[model samples]
Target chain A: MQAWDISFSKLKAGYGSHVVLTDVTAALPAGAVSVILGGSGCGKSTLLRQIIGLSKPLSGEVRVAGRDICTLPPAEFRRVRRRMGVLFQDGALLGALTLAQNVALPLTEHLNLPAEAVRAEAVRILGMVGLSDFADFYPNELSGGMRKRAGLARAIIAQPRILLCDEPTSGLDPITAARMDDLLLSMHRRFPEMTIVSVSHDLASLNRIADYVLVLRDGACVFAGTQDALRASDDPYLVRFLNRDGAGDDAAAGECAAPAVQASLDRWFAS
Target chain B: MPQRNADDISRASPPVKVLRLLGRPALRALNAMGSVTLFMLDGLRHIFTTRRILGRTVRQIYVIGYQSLFVILLIGLFCGMVLGLQGYYTLVRFGSVGMLGSAVSLTMIRELGPVLTAIMLTGRAGSSMTAEIGVMRITDQIDALDVMDINSVAYLVSPRIVAALLSFPMLTAIFDVTGIFGGYLTGVCMLDINEGAYLYRIVSSVTMTDVAGGFLKALVFGLLVTTVCCHQGYKAHLRRDSVGPEAVGSATTSAVVISCVLILAADYVLTSILL
Candidate 1:
């Protein structure tokens, strides 16, 4: 597997007319962990989707390695896409398949491996994710964290050079989230040249695993640089985000409350 | 304040407003038809191009064909028995009770066999296809496939469509046979309409053209139903009627309704052509 640098040159993306990411321009480094930082609905997932070629950008270019994927023909783009893996939120493992079967999908679909070889590879990946015991369990039977691990196993089974994770630690307990972060780090160690890009708001995980950071806010890329640069910056929005400020929350809380709602709450809880 | 009607809303004349109302749905229906056709073509293309499709296709056949056998048998038997009873009585009225076999066999072979089989499968397998694909769409499994550089349509839909193609005619034949037997139970066993007369008329009245037409209808109905159901599920995310989990339910409902309607409509057209 060869790590591929992903560069977005003035990329704009969204569904139909509702633009979620506007004029975004940044390059995620090859052979390193780059964390995309943003609040919910701040175009983090949209950017990840654009990079993964799940949806084409409305305008501009997304270059993988050196080729602009947006301009590539469908057949050509599919070849480029084969070098990548994506871990979606909620795991997104197929409910019909067992954990090992889900993990084996990429290999079985893309390669000419025999059944035993594919199973062996799947088991190895599952073991990496610490899900060897639950190989036969359906996705629905597993907990959310376990499913996420299985999703990670499936994503990396083919040893893709470019790995994109969408909020990988979003809904996990502290211990599980930490384990997931460590697992991602270990993956980077195993595949030293693999480029790992994660979309997340987890400051802790970002601090631990991120070699580079790209922060998005209000449909724009606010910052694209090293984590140290992001930390040392004095920008107000960046400062607020980095410090986990509650000022915006207070303002939103003010607008969200009403006297009618307060009165209803009082009446309801009066008993 | 008074309640406003369509005339008050946009200041358009009644005729223009009516035309506007009708045009919107008419255009939407046309767009849906075009989309379903394109989806079928795409799925059909993948049937030839996808590697290792046989295993998936066989699995789908088991689900869509083998699993539906009992229901098809049950429905076919009842349909046949009802036809025999009704045909027997109707012929008895004209002192032509011997025509019961021709009536039951011809009816099953020409029309009811293919149409009922498709409708039954639409309810049984078609709805499941829609719901399953719809869920996949909502849950990002389809996108997962896309990210994996695997053709989601090839993986999810092409197999089902191929399975339906192979399954529909076979099931229709079964339905026809079961229905004729059902007719025998009612006409020959119950009414004592002369068993040989019943079987002999069935063989005499059913021509090769009739059987071919029935099979052709079966194939077309299978394609239409499977394609429509899969399309609804595949594009569940784009549905304007709902979003997220609700979209899956809406897509499934729309798939089954649209499939059933298409089956009946296609049956009419095919029957007209075959006749």
Candidate 2:
């Protein structure tokens, strides 16, 4: 359980012929829950992809534990990736495999563990996610919240040093989202050395689980500090986002006055 | 404003518009070919590089090969019966009814057996493979594999390719045997042909070379159909607005059409060489 910090320096990422994020630089502290906050299409997911080595940056470097992963060869990159786990937005569980089998996939693929051990570990992790009873069910048979929980169990089963979650609370009810936030915080507490980077639009979940916050706007790191610092700041985008005023629309004004700031603050803290 | 639009249309002209329309797809096809070639090469490399995929390849053989046995057998029987009926009537008119055995056996071994087997597989197994992989792509399962440090091509595509390559020739052999028996049922049992002449004529006319050539053709057709299907499925995300069943449906249709065309084209080329 060694701590490893993730650093991005001048990282530019995008698809072919389109640039999403540019000149982004940040160092996610070791052994902390770092929440990346941004509206949809703000390149939060894109940056996550770069960090996971699923896609290379358009320019600059992504360093994991002081090693530049951007220049690593395929074999070396895979070695680096083996130390990390990712929970995708849709769970991305193999529909053909049952919940237990899905959780055991990384273990079965990467390790030569005995079948009994694989099954035992898979069941143990499923229990941690409160899904031990649903071990035999396929992903499609599970509810949306169950699927996300199963995905989380799979992500952490390998004991990865870094856990990347993409919108884990998305598409869930408020109660379910709160439970998800609790599970994430519990996971962080359990593996005190693991760095958890979650990209989310859920302000409530962010306030509950985040030890540090990174706010992205139009593919730039507009703010990077603690939740308390973020709340005390007078930044317009942060204020607008914190208030949940027209958060879905990209054209929403950052310069608009925060009319119900006190009520929003109360609601945020209450959740 | 209407006149200005008309002027703009005229400025482009019919020939230029036609060229633009034709050029885009032509370039797209070329690009697809290049990408598919690279994917196939990667798959080939992984076939030897990874030994773990052997079990998956065997499982795939059961799904892609063993499951298709009944349909392939039915098609072979009906096809041979039709060939026997038609050849018998034509040869009878020319007073060469004794040659019916040679005609049916030659046709089955050299051409129809390999070609029809490929077409059936393209429709049955090839389309299914495309749809399965397409679903995996759109659902982000493939991306999940990538992030897990698994080579998606090695884990997914290579096993399928290996299974298809092994199964096709065996399926073609089954088609040949059943087809010959089907011709026997029609030619001797129904057409009043001499039984000794029928069996003897086939024995003398069809050589080891012909059987070998037929097997080679089947092997090639299997590679083509599987490669095309896998390529289509792997590249499903590249298609604009394609998702879920729409992506799967399009990939399945495209795999069948493209595999059938390539089978026919390769048939001509192989015929020239083998014959």
lDDT of each: 0.92, 0.90
Per candidate, native contacts kept equal 0.87, 0.70
Query: Clashes per prediction?
Result: 0, 0
TM-score of 1: 0.94
**What local lDDT score does residue B193 receive in model 1, on the 0 to 100 scale?**
93
Where is model 1 more than 4 Å wrong at Cα?
A: A251-271, B1-26
Per-model DockQ against the true two-chain complex: 0.78, 0.54
- B142: Cα error in model 1, Å: 0.8
**Model 1 C-alpha lDDT per residue in residues A71-188, reported as the tens digit of each score:** 8988998888887888899999999899999999988897898999998889988999999988989999999999999999998887789989999999899999999999999999
Q: Tell how far residue A45 is off in model 1, in angstroms.
A: 0.3
Docking quality level of the chain pair in candidate 1: medium
lDDT (Cα, tens digit) per residue for candidate 1, span B1-275: 22355446368877988887788789998998898888899999999999989999999999999999999999999999999999988999999898899999999999999999999999999989999999999999999988887899999999998999999999999999999999999999999999999989988888999999999999999999999899999999998879998999998899889888888888889888889
